[model samples]
Target: MSSYSGNVETGGAPDVRNLPGLRITKLSVGPMDNNAYLLECLSNEDLLLIDAANEAPRLLELVGDRALSTVVTTHQHMDHWVALEEVVAATGARALAHPDDAEGLPISTSPVVDGDRIPIGDCELEVIHLVGHTPGSIALVYRDPKGTPHLFTGDSLFPGGVGNTHDDPEAFASLIGDIETKLFGALPDETWFYPGHGKDSTLGAERPSVPEWRARGW
Candidate 1:
């Protein structure tokens, strides 16, 4: 777990890769240049994307006829999901997310919840609740036998800041508390955070920033 998170800028495309057990790649999309990730966990062909938005052409180019498994979303934001139907059409993969986030999706689907685990090849993904950014937002934890745990957080948790919120002040605070109680402070120092909009970070790297974030009351 390292705090070496990358703060990517707008317009730049997401970096692509094929890692052990999980092939995670980031796609830059939307007006805000949100990041959408495409993953191939175990067995190399089943693709699971974290978020899909503006870069349909590039995303398709990346897929290039691979077998798609599913599209898992952290939460529903238009920039993170505008190209969903295209993703589904191209890959024949279903879109899944927390039930609270279903309302925010372009197409309708049943909401996902905490404690649900979905399997992809030999890997298993555990859904964790860290609902601060959005009432239905979720963080996905994927642990491989290699001992590195990956946390795919939507807008909930980030490297130095949490997701932006304007709905309920109490809920926003609650979300922050949840991240402390259940995420960076709660999980092992090595847990990796894969956020929806920015670069990758870890528990050790993101922990010290929490108090500062809370201090500003943002």
Candidate 2:
């Protein structure tokens, strides 16, 4: 596998990671600098996109001539799906999102709850529902048999803290609590996590800050 920094800039080249059986491409788009991820199964070339964000043309170009199997929206936030309808229309890919945030999307989406597995050629991504960022925000977990786990956390988890809860203590508590138990508590320290925006981070790098994040209440 090549060294992937997971660093991307809007209108620039995407950072690609070649894993054992899958390839991950990360791109930054829109004014919000939302990060969109493309996962391709090496065996069959099955493609899955996480978050359309913006710049439909660029996302479509990223897919090239290949068909996109699915597009999974992490949350109901507007910035995350600005290109969703266009991309899905262009690729004829199935749209998937959590039920609570499904109505916020431009098009109809198949609801996926926690524990649901989304197939991508020979590999699959497991769903992990995380609340607070939105009524139904989710993360995707890809457990590579030959390597450590990978997570797509959307706006739920970031390098320094969880997603914004609008200063609502209740919401922040819920998000942090779920992240601690479901993410930090369950996944290994080596697990690499890609967020909806900005840079990527490993679980081990952020584990020690969980207490601080909770205390800060962001």
Candidate 3:
């Protein structure tokens, strides 16, 4: 089994997970404790960072001398992209986000819709647009040929339930519906997902609670 615990803390050491062709480094930063994931293709060492949450200095330190190719913001949340401008400016990496939330970001981002494929050297990530947390909130899926699929869910999903919808019944419905159909429905139980905050979980671990989440309507 993988040694990665998926546990990180603000100002703490990051946890690293190694896959067949990819290496994932998870670090927590900012006051909100947002998780930033660095996906490196083992073949070429090309890197793609999944959220420039905060603390540009720490992020840059983690990157070291490697070139960062792209920075994909999970959503438009201020806490999530607080370090986007700085990280992008420092690394000269291209910024990418869903078109619906692009305007909220500090820097201009190229739109990446559902089903769009992002390449990090030889490995690729498929974008899955999840509505509710934000109009363009997305999760990136990396299907490992040698292991189970890995999902990087922004605020759209978590261990216990879906992201907050500010108690809007309609928004909750849309978010839950999309998550059910697009995420839980399409992906297998073994798929392991890393959320924007907190620890990681597998679909199997959270699958049983889907009904409870829908009924409570939070």
Total clashing pairs for each candidate:
3, 0, 0
RMSD of 3: 0.7
> In model 2, which regions exceed 4 Å deviation?
none
Enumerate residue pairs that collide in model 1. Answer: 98-112, 99-111, 99-112
Residue 83 shift from truth in candidate 2, angstroms: 0.7
Query: How close is every model to the real structure, measured as TM-score?
Result: 0.88, 0.99, 0.99
Stretches of candidate 1 off by over 4 Å are 1-13
Weakest ten-residue segment in model 1 by summed lDDT: 1-10
Badly placed stretches (over 4 Å) of model 3 are none
Q: Model 2: how large is the Cα RMSD against the reference?
A: 0.7
lDDT of 3 by residue, 45-96 (tens): 9999999999999999989999999999999999999999999999999999
Worst 10 residues of 2 by lDDT: 209-218
Q: For residues 131-169, write the lDDT of model 2, one tens digit per residue.
A: 888889999999999999999999999999999999888
| lDDT for 174 (candidate 3) | 93
Candidate 2 local distance difference test against the native: 0.96
